[model samples]
Structures are given as C-alpha cells and as structure tokens.
Target: MITVKAPGKLYIAGEYAVLEPGHPALVVALDRFITVSITETQDQGTINSRQYLETNFHWRRRGDQMIFDNRDNPYHYILEAIRVVEALALEMGHTLRVFDLDINSQLEDQGGRKYGLGSSAAVTVATVKALIEFYQLPLNRLDIFKLAAIAHFNVQGNGSLGDIAASVFGGWIAFSTFDKDWLRTVLKNNTFSEIIASDWPGLKIELLRVPSELELLIGWTGSPASTSHLVDRITIAKFAQKQQYQNFLESSRRCVETMIKGIKAAEVNVIKDGIRLNRQLIKQLGVFSQVDIETPELAELCQIAEDYGGAAKSSGAGGGDCGIVLTDHSVDQARLISAWNQHQITTLPLTVFELTGANV
Candidate 1:
C-alpha cells in the first residue's frame, strides 16, 4: 500500500496580489491535512468499490466507474480528487484495477470549506501523490505540481497556484512570477538547492493552533461567493487603472516584508502589528460588501476577538467563508469564547504547525 499525506496551507502574505504577474507571496503549511492511501486489489484488472468500511472508508474502481458510499457532502472533495487521479492514469496509458483507496481529511475549523487554508490544494497534492505511487509513474515534484494545478483549475478556476506550491514544497517560500518562467528556470538550475546549501539561517515560523481555552469563532455569510468571480472582478479593476487596488497591493507587499522581519525577530508585538496592517490592507480591496470583512457574523466575531486582545481576518477568497483569529492570553480567550457563545458562532481550536514537505 502507498500512503500520501499532504498538509493544508495558510497565506501569511500576498493573498490576492500573488496572482499578479510580478508579485510574490509567502505561505505556511498547516497541520490540517488530507491523507490518501491506496493498495492493489486481487482482481488486478477489474474495478470494484465500497464505502465506509467497518474498519476504514473504502473506495474501489469497477471498470470505468468509481463507486463509494456517501457518508457526507464534504466527500465531494474526495470524489473530485479521485477524478484527477483517474485522468492521470488514463494519460499514462495504464489502468488501475481493484484498488482500495481511503481518504481522510482534517480541516474542521473552516466548517468543511475555507479559502485561505488550501483544502482543495491539499487534497489535490495527496491525490496526485497516491496515483503516482500506485502507477509507479516516473514523475518528479514538478510533474506532481502540473497535475495538481490541473485539478485546482478544474475545482477553482484560475486558482492562485501559490497554495499548491506551498503544500508541495513546504516551509516558508518567497514565490514570484516576476519573469513568468523564472520558477521553471530556478527549478532546472537547482536554485533552490543552492539557496538551501548556503550558510543563511532558515526562516522561523510559529504554528499556533487555537488554544483549547479559547474559541476560534467562524461564521459563514449565507451567500456563496465564487473565487473566480472575485478574481475576475479584481483583474478587471486592475486593468482599468484602479489606483486604490494598486495601492493595496503595494501595501500588502510591505506588510509581507514586515511579517518576515517579525517572524525572524520573534517579536510578538511586531507580528501583531503586521497582522492588523495586513487586515487593513485587505479591507481596502473593497471586496466585502456591507461589512469590513465578509459576513456580518464574521465581522461581529472579529470584533469579539479584538475585544479579547486578538486579531481576526478573512481566511480566503473573501466574499464569504471562514475567519482566522490568533490569541494567546488566557483571560482574553475566555472573553472571546464568551462573546462567540453569545453570538452563537461556531468556534474551533487552531494551532500553527511546522511547514514540511508532503512525503507521507
């Protein structure tokens, strides 16, 4: 059996601007993950499937049709992931038969759907890795990236791609599309290796999961916003010479630099300031209507977090989804949780984890 576990990601900086041609972004891999395990079946050439195993969830391929039991709607993400693997197998002129695949994902904080955490990208990464191992395909990280990109495009049209790259590579990365082809050149020329081999100290990161004593409240705006729609709107606005948007990007870039410095220096106050500044910059984008963030519920929650001495911001593509909040003080956490309870917002505990490559 081959198992692949891919971590989800959080964009610490360069959220929407990363999609621009010359902008760079930084991201961190979270402990939240999507894991896939696959093994060959006795019926080497035929496909059969099962769902929700007594011991573990099961999925089997029978001929061209893949079947599995539906335990939840979130499994739709898993189904989408399988489709990508199936397509890749066909491209390789090989068919996988009697394969038992199990998918397990952990991202409850987003209530199963969050933007900034890269849940889809994580699934894509794990699915691609499982397929590569199952077919014994001779593909490297770049090859996996290409496949994951295809899946991401299919799921979320014109995805930022930064999330997938972060999930696949892990650690803090300064990614730029400045030259468009620069990334490919760097990979081919071993630029990453050269940088790692140097004597420079690696970046420092703190993974703060929501403490059990505190509640990380997340409220969804009833309206579902398409990431593609927002991206298109921003693109058109940028093309039309929207000075505010440009200023937002520039400010975001500066915030990114400050964040890097804060992380390096281990200054909690600087980190807090950077978070607040970044939130203000995102608010300037004017993507959220009627609310400074996304949903009124989320905005209210942010207020509660702020009252508790924490900071809150929208997690992803922004029309509506989850909000991320960070707080370490216990008294503040108690007040935050009380506020969330009064408002009836769902809360979860989140922790920051070290960013590591997806090899398991």
Candidate 2:
C-alpha cells in the first residue's frame, strides 16, 4: 500500500483581493492533513472514506475508462482526480491498473464538521498525489498542483484556487490567483488536454520566508461558513458598486503588500498596522458590498486578540469559521488562546506545516 498526505491551508491576508488577477495573498499550510492510502485489490477497486463518504465506492472499468458502481458518490474530488489522471495516462498511451483507495483527513472530526482549513483542497491534492504515484507519472509538485486546480475548477466553477496552491506548496507562500480572463479565453479555445499541454501562464506562486519569532494563534468560532457561498455573494456585490469595490481592492492590495514586507522584515509594528487596516477595509467592503461577511462572534474574537496585543481577524470568508492572531512572542500566543477559551471559542493547536522531504 502507498500512502500520501497533503496539508490544509490558512489565509493570513488577501482573502477577497486574491480572487482578482495579479494580486498576491499570504497563505500558510497547517499541520492538519488529508491522507490517502492506496492498496491493490483482486476483483474490483474500492474507494472508502469513512471520514467523509461513510461507505466504500467500488470502481469498474468500461474499456479504457474507469466508472464507479454508484454514480452519486459524495467524494467528488477523489473521482475527479481519478478521471483526470486516467485521461492523461491514456493520452500518454499508458493504461492503468486499479486499486482500492482509503481516504482520511485530520482537518475534520468524525462528525463531519469542517474547520474551514481547506479540507476540500487538501483532499484534492492528496488524491492527485496518490494517483501520480500509482500511475508513475513524471510530474512535479507544481504539475500536480496544476492538475488539482483544473480538477477543482471542473467540479466547482468558481474559486481563486489559493487553497489549492497552499495545499501543493506547503508552508508559507505568496500566491496570485490564476488569470481568470486568460483562463476563460483558453477554455473557450482549447481542449482540457491541450490546455494542460503548455505552461500555465495565468498563475504565479512562490515560497515566502517567515520569521522564526512569529507565532500563529488560530481560534475556531464553532460555526462553519461556506466559502463558495461567501465568495459568490462578494462577487455579485463587487459588480453592484464597481467604483466603491475598486477602491476597497486598491487599499487591500496595499495592506497585503505591507503585511508581506512586515513578515519578511520581522517588524511587528508594520505587521500590526497592516492587520488593523486590512480588517477595517474588509469590514468596509462588507458595508459597501451589502454582504454580511463578518459576524458578531468574529468581531468579538478580533477585539479580544487586539486587547491582548495581537493582530487578529477572520481568516477566510468571515461569516464564521476561524480567525488568526499574529504575535511576535509565544507568550501572546498562549495568552490569546486562554482568553479566547474564556469566551467559548476553541483555539486550535496548529502550527505551520513546513515541507520536509516529501513530494506532493
């Protein structure tokens, strides 16, 4: 059996702005991961994910194509990965043998409650990794990332794919969303295989250096927000008042830029300033866009962190889920968690997931 794993992601800054082309966001991979275990079977192949699907999905081959016995399997990402890798392998004149897949994730509890830690992206990356290994495909981490991005886009029509990039690269990263305009145009002009044939020009991702003195305190609000729903609402709001949103975008870009520089330089003041302004701008965006992005609980969480001398804000879509506190000292990290616990918010025991000698 071969087992592969991919980490979940957290957004440090640049949530909505990163959706646009050419804008950069700070993303970090956390220790939580999705794991995929593949084992050879005799009669038929099975995909079992008790953590998610609660039942095994058996696979059958119809000529060169792989088909599932039950068509309505809940684990769509895993199915997408199989279909993608199978098509690519056939294109390369290589036929694949089947195997049973056992999938699990640390990003969610057995109750199926997500922490908003990019579990979907992690599963996608893990599935892609396991298939690449099984098929013996000559693909690098970046190649797998691209394949996962395409697979996810095929499943869900909208996303910046920042989580996909984070799941691929691991650790601290500066990521730009793929060029939506160019991608849309290419999709119109070329087939999926032909599009994957060339170097993707729409995306840019790189590793960023994080200071050793910094610490992250993640607090969960116990409410899961649907990111796609939040993103869809925000997109509609942006077009409703283009001028106002445009201004918000400009300020957001600058705030993220400053935060990046602050992390690089280990300047707490600069980082704090950026975090404060960024949260305020995001709040204003909610007002201008007429979307209830931030919740009262999240606001109280941020206020608590700020009172403890840490820069805190809602990490992702902001209706609920989790928030982060950036502090220069470990003492602040401990204190923030304690205070948040007092308010009934649980602090996740997570740290940055640095890629250490593993591919995919």
Residue-pair clashes per prediction, in order, are 13, 0
| lDDT for position 335 in model 2 | 74
- Candidate 2 runs further than 4 Å off: 54-74, 185-194, 358-360
Predictions: Cα RMSD each: 8.7, 5.8
lDDT of 1 by residue, 26-104 (tens): 5666667777788777755322222212122335599998765332223444566567666556666777666777777
On residues 1-360, what C-alpha lDDT tens digit does candidate 2 reach at each position?
Answer: 989999999998888988887777888999999999988777799988777754345577999999863322337878987888777777667777879999888987566777889877888889889888888888877778878887776776677898998998898888888866676687678765676766776477888877777778888888877777688889998889899888888888888888888878878778777878888888998888777767888898999999988888888778898888888763466677788889999888899988877453
Tell me the whole-model lDDT of each prediction, alpha carbons only.
0.59, 0.81
**lDDT of candidate model 1 versus the reference:** 0.59
Best by TM-score: 2
User: Worst ten-residue run, lDDT, model 2?
Assistant: 68-77
lDDT value, candidate 2, whole model: 0.81
- What TM-score against the true fold does each predicted structure earn? 0.67, 0.90
